[model samples]
Target chain A: MSGRSRSRQSSSVRISDEQITDLVHKLQQLLPEIRNRHSDKVSAAKVLQETCNYIRSLHREVDDLSERLSELLATSDTAQAAIIRSLLTQ
Target chain B: MANSKSAITLLNSTSSRLCFARTSATFASAPPDQLKRQSRRIKMAAYSSMARVAGRRRAWARALLFRLHTRPRHKTLMRRKRRPSTSSDDMVGKLRRLLPGGETMDVCTLLEETANYIHCLSTQVKVMKAISNHHLSKVN
Candidate 1:
């Protein structure tokens, strides 16, 4: 029974390893920063680091845009506010 | 409703901390649980969007702010740590620096978290883009 369970565990680990490789491939494709680099040499960790940096920049961009939107809405007249409110709800 | 309220809260928070570092030593670290919660928040956001409900898209925004707020306190602690080992181990160390709460994770868990993080980030970008496009069209 123990031997059988061990084999099963090993197979599960192998499956997960394959899944990780697939995920790494997907991540590599999504990141334009890493796309120009030699695929054979770039490591998964490097891809992850690039991805983290990309996400951080995107987060910052979103924050900036949201603040600007709020400012525009705040300064605009009621009609503009009504339009945006409608747009958001739709 | 709750979604717009969270967006307002996100706007009300510290304006911007847009530092982009590629290989900086002063990377921030977070507990693994928080990372999991961030992923959960993203899932909630996705579910709401799919259901055509006004969802709290600001969860990731708040998380980003939280990371920036917490960055300074962990710098020295992060730099001081050492784990000397194989080449793959060095790669793991780099990943630990990259992912939030990655410092304590095993390789499997790290990969899982990375997947979730990537998905959340893409969703965030999409949501933000949609919002921006909506507003820009209205103003123009």
Candidate 2:
């Protein structure tokens, strides 16, 4: 009975060591994937930020164009009214 | 016979009058200066529409980034906690108690769990890549 229990204990230690070795190997395999994922996320975020900046610039340009259009329309309307009034008086 | 001829003449005169009225109406509605201004207004409208579309795409990209940022982080790998050293037997005993199985079974379960974690990470990365592509296409 003493010999049998001693053999079982040693077997258990071997099994545990094998399990630990397998876990370490799996972890090592995952390291590259983790690093790649981190880099991808960083690059994606940078692109997204640049897109936002470009959109903001486009919005500003649209606003400026609309303002200028409004000013041009108002001046044209006044000039047309003046021309019609002068023709009427003549 | 005279009444029919007069009716035909009246019809011809009215057609000519209608044509003149149409031309005069067009001229009054769109003079040279007004036509130029109208074209400019149309061009501005097109640009504004393009800007609105760009703004919408930006919002979508921003939301995607927000979701990615809010995802549950890998806490175990991200933050390593220091622990006091223990004997190999004690550590194995603790693992056995936590795992509630023999060595082979414990190893299988741990491998399965790590595989699932990696799978989840891969899916998240795919989603981020897709979002990035979408943003790039919209920008172009």
What is candidate 2's lDDT per residue for B8-96, written digit by digit as tens?
Answer: 33323322332232233323335555544443442333332222322222322222233334535333111125355475334333332
List each candidate's DockQ score: 0.12, 0.03
Instruction: State the TM-score for model 2.
Output: 0.24
lDDT of each: 0.47, 0.35
lDDT per residue as tens, model 1, B1-140:
86455443332221111101101112234345443333333333332232222212323233334453455642421133555645644655766665555665556556655555555545545554554465567667
lDDT of 2: 0.35
Native contacts retained, all candidates in order: 0.13, 0.02
Error of 2 at A29 (Å): 0.9
> Per-model TM-score of chain A alone?
0.63, 0.38
Report the number of the highest-TM-score candidate.
1
- Considering the two chains of model 2, state its CAPRI-style docking category: incorrect
Output DockQ, candidate 2.
0.03
Residue B19's lDDT within candidate 2 is 28
Kindly report the docking quality category of candidate 1: incorrect
Who wins the lDDT comparison?
A: 1
